[model samples]
Target: MKDRFDYGQNPEKTKGGELIAAYLCDPETADAEFLLSKAKYKAITGREQKKNADILCYQIRQSFLPGEITPEDANRIGYEMGMRWTKGKYAFFVATHIDRHHIHNHIYYNSTALDCTRKFRDFIGSARAVRHLSDRICLENGLSYIAHPKLHSKGKFKHYGEWQDDNRPPTFQERLKAQIDSCLAEKPQSMAAFLQAMVSAGYEVKHGRGGVISFRAEGQKRFTRLRSSTLGKGYGQEDIQAVVEGRAASSEGRGAPPRKVNLIIDIQSRMKAGKGPAYERWAKIFNLKQMAATLQYLQESGLLEYEQLEKRATGAADRFHVLSGQIKSIEGAMSVNAELKAAIMDYAKTRPAFKGYEAAKYSKKYLAEHEAEIALYRAAQATFRHVLSGAKLPKMDALKAEYQKLAAEKRAAYRDYRAVRKDMQEVVTAKANIDHLFGLTDTQKNKEQER
Candidate 1:
């Protein structure tokens, strides 16, 4: 950024190529013109070709060293990258050894196409691929490469308000859950102990409409947990006691039931893989041990009532495991096909024979045959990719529209199940609270035993 300079929208140094070649030798006029024409400048910058040409000249020296490279070494590296990356159907420019700060090259390749089509437009993820290419080039030469800024920020996920880059306020549920979690985390225990801990943490609890509960800290309503929704995972003593007993308790007593427990874990495995980029959305969704634990928790707590009644929901979850395997296979095949296509197309681009059958390179027929193979391979690869993408799923035009429909139905089912469990737990928490905290009378005990 610091080194790059502008020469307006057009270049005044018409012999910019000669300037580049000057590092190796005093380039002849004919050779300079040939270099400029080879740059394919018009194809790359489109209407702004000359502007790009000037910038390339300005930046080329920073890319490599002029005094260090031998003439043959410069030619070889230039020829090699040209062969390795060029798309056979695109116009590309290449120049080297300019007597500037360094003996580097500039390539003004037609970012659009040589197939005389805009097929590359909106094509895959190639738009931001230059960073990968630049790093790869430095790596190939055993040189240090600069890291892209966005790539470094990719994994910084946090739930804190100050952590958010966007200024939007957190959803009420999110704020409430954070507060509840903070209070309960003072100490960890079964449902009763957690409620007792919340009380000790100086939270004043009160009931809200629709069976919800609010906890205020320092006279400020900082948290609220819903009683019956499959929302945040906090529960009040009443909410916990009501679950195991199969009904909300008439009064706090000593007839509480046992608490339900669940486990969560993240697991990973490795595979022998090749050089292509693999798509793995399914991998995050499918972990056998975690899924098994979740399933057992749901069953022991009676969370999936409809699935338990018909025995279909657990089976559907099992099918997701199978789907994960299929996705892995699809990604592997796509990787192989795409990599092969790039390698072959690049070879043809710099091979001279494909450039209208120059004798120094392969024959035009040879390049034609490779293109035919790429077409066939691309077709087959796409079919497999579509199949593994779960063809049975309905197409989603809007992210929220799809999430809303899926999450709503799933949450409704989960809510019914969690509510039943919560009712039972509330009975346990209430009974425990009375007996332990307030102490029970003989008559109250007799009544609890009578039930």
Candidate 2:
């Protein structure tokens, strides 16, 4: 139990212990507290709880999808789940670990009741109950949860990372969309030719009532209707007809924005790996389309000249960095302000207890009775000493005003930061595509700039 607690509260995993939270006990001393509870249980019941027969604590691991939750929120969610599960009867601590790609929480709660008169017993279907409770909490916090979870043959669910690794195969609708995209890329001359092209690509096309076109791939049980409602707007019969007649642009018929231009594959390298003429032809066409898109974007952005495009890309990158630094600075100030505010409130609430202890001349009995309050007061004093040094503490109203001002500044900076980041990304991507198309290496680019 101690080993598990140590592992869960590893400083490296929990951001140097910053992401740890406890309820009813100090997290650092929680193991000792649990041991103390066991001793009390033995004294009350006259039964020494054997290590093998007794459960020391329970650990719940709650994981979040990568990038879906922040570490602080994960810790809070874990703490809330523990409180709900234990009903405030147990002491627990939640340690949020961000050492892996996915953020997860490790909650360890004592098995003995807070009063040390009873022990928690595991019941049937408790695992399912925990899962349902976790799902409910996740949804309440606006996080996604698996609605229909599948169990493995062993009657257990796969690990989160394993589930992510086993990416589901593309659905029938997705496969059909890809086939349609490929057929459209060939620029079929007529609807008849388009249907024929699909047939050649291993699809069975059917002309249904009201001129509705349906298609079924090999081994498919049912034919999928190629209607605006079924296959989305761009794959509708009318849209395809317009594209065939050259009445609408191919991109418009596809019902999606143009894909960003990307670097072309190295055909020579691919051919050395045994690619045939058909593959080479496809690669050449793909490269041609990408170059066309690149040129169009350059024309629209007024960056036809390489020098102007390079300069704009550099300026966009610099602006993005400046905005990012500003947001970080504002966020740091807000964190300090929040911490100080909390300390001030804690100090105020515990002031009466500290004064009574002082009046009692720091009597042992008084100190024992008011231990928690005195500890809180001392913590707040330490915080003030560290944060304010010798300076006078600011008023709560002043701190609140400062925090609000910093938050407003952060919001404004964040908006500009997002805009600058997007601009930087687009400009940088365009510059990279241009370099790849022109076969310009970094050394060559530097030489050209010098020239």
Candidate 3:
């Protein structure tokens, strides 16, 4: 079992509703968002009517041993755990999500108490307390709990889905680590040789006053100390020195042995077109290797039949289309919001100038001097007034703040959109490659038609 907390809500952020939607998305599950409300305002609308936006909600998650508990049981356990932990002080909602590899619980609680007077005390070490409370709950429910000693200190905290879907570029350190491992595999004769090899690999090497070496990988802004703890023990100065002296061979002792990947390319078969006798033999070998790789991929994925491959590929494509549509929708909304905010700001800024222009009775000299400003004011005034539509316009600062909030939401939405986009691209690429291997591409169809 594991627990994580998203502590202390930011005033600008509005993730409460999104969190609710995410955890309650599984249609098959009952009692999703099982609210344990203590406040007089039970419904979300009533809760929002309080008008206290700061610290809208507190979100936390508890993940269980996969395949151990059913969704129904998990929901009950999560509800019980949430209520007990909150001590009936804060109104909370428990949502058990069974859509991924792990059955997890998402708990969101109103920061304000039932009386709507006092707020939840979010002090230092509150996260640990929540985990401890969860462990007790798990143990009481006959579920295994992760003990303190078994927990990892420095580790990824993302849920399985989030981690699998993350598609950000590799960090500089990751690239550098791969380079170092590859260089070490070649068995460099000395530290100097290693440094030279690093430079050749497109990294800038700098020696400090105390014999410490730092490396700056290509496109990296800062030099990283080669002895930093983030690189682990074996990649440090002492470890490299040991390797240079032939005391250590590779990074294998520091971690698991590297797994080799076999490539799939059929160069030898192509060479067998009889262009040249000697080259044909080599080409045959290359073609055999490529076919071997493709076959291996199919075997691993259990894609034994053409129909299976086709279905998988088309499914991936369909998902890509859906995700593309979602991205476009979000982008469109963001653009409209931005344009509206800009128009409002422009109208407000040019109000005084417009008044002066009106008082001057649309003088040609004044119009020429501030044509753009006057036109913007005239164009936006009606739109802005129409937006207000019989209601008094809010303060300029308030409008700007609302725009900022919308902008933040758009940014968060884009982050998710980008992750989905990356996933779509990967699946689409895999599908195309599979189709090509099977001679199912449009080009192949054209060739068959020609034949």
Reference-based lDDT, each prediction: 0.41, 0.83, 0.62
The candidate with the higher TM-score, 2 or 3, is: 2
Return whichever of 1 and 3 wins on lDDT.
3
Evaluation by TM-score, superior candidate among 1 and 3? 3
Question: Which runs of model 1 end up more than 4 angstroms from their true locations?
Answer: 1-84, 87-108, 111-132, 141-194, 201-212, 216-221, 225-238, 244-451
TM-score of each: 0.28, 0.52, 0.34
**Model 3 stretches astray by more than 4 angstroms:** 1-290, 365-372, 379-451
Per-residue accuracy of model 3 over 65-171 as CA lDDT, tens digit each: 98888767776777777687778866666656666788777777666565343457587457777888888988888898776323323333655444433122346
Residue 379 of model 2 has an lDDT of: 82
- Residue-wise C-alpha lDDT for candidate 2, range 198-223, written one tens digit per residue: 99998999888998899998768999
Instruction: Please provide, for model 1 over 229-329, each residue's C-alpha lDDT reduced to its tens digit, 9 standing for 90 to 100.
Output: 63422244455555334354321223323222211111222223322122122222223323443445455546454334234333433454454555445
> Model 1: how large is the Cα RMSD against the reference?
19.3
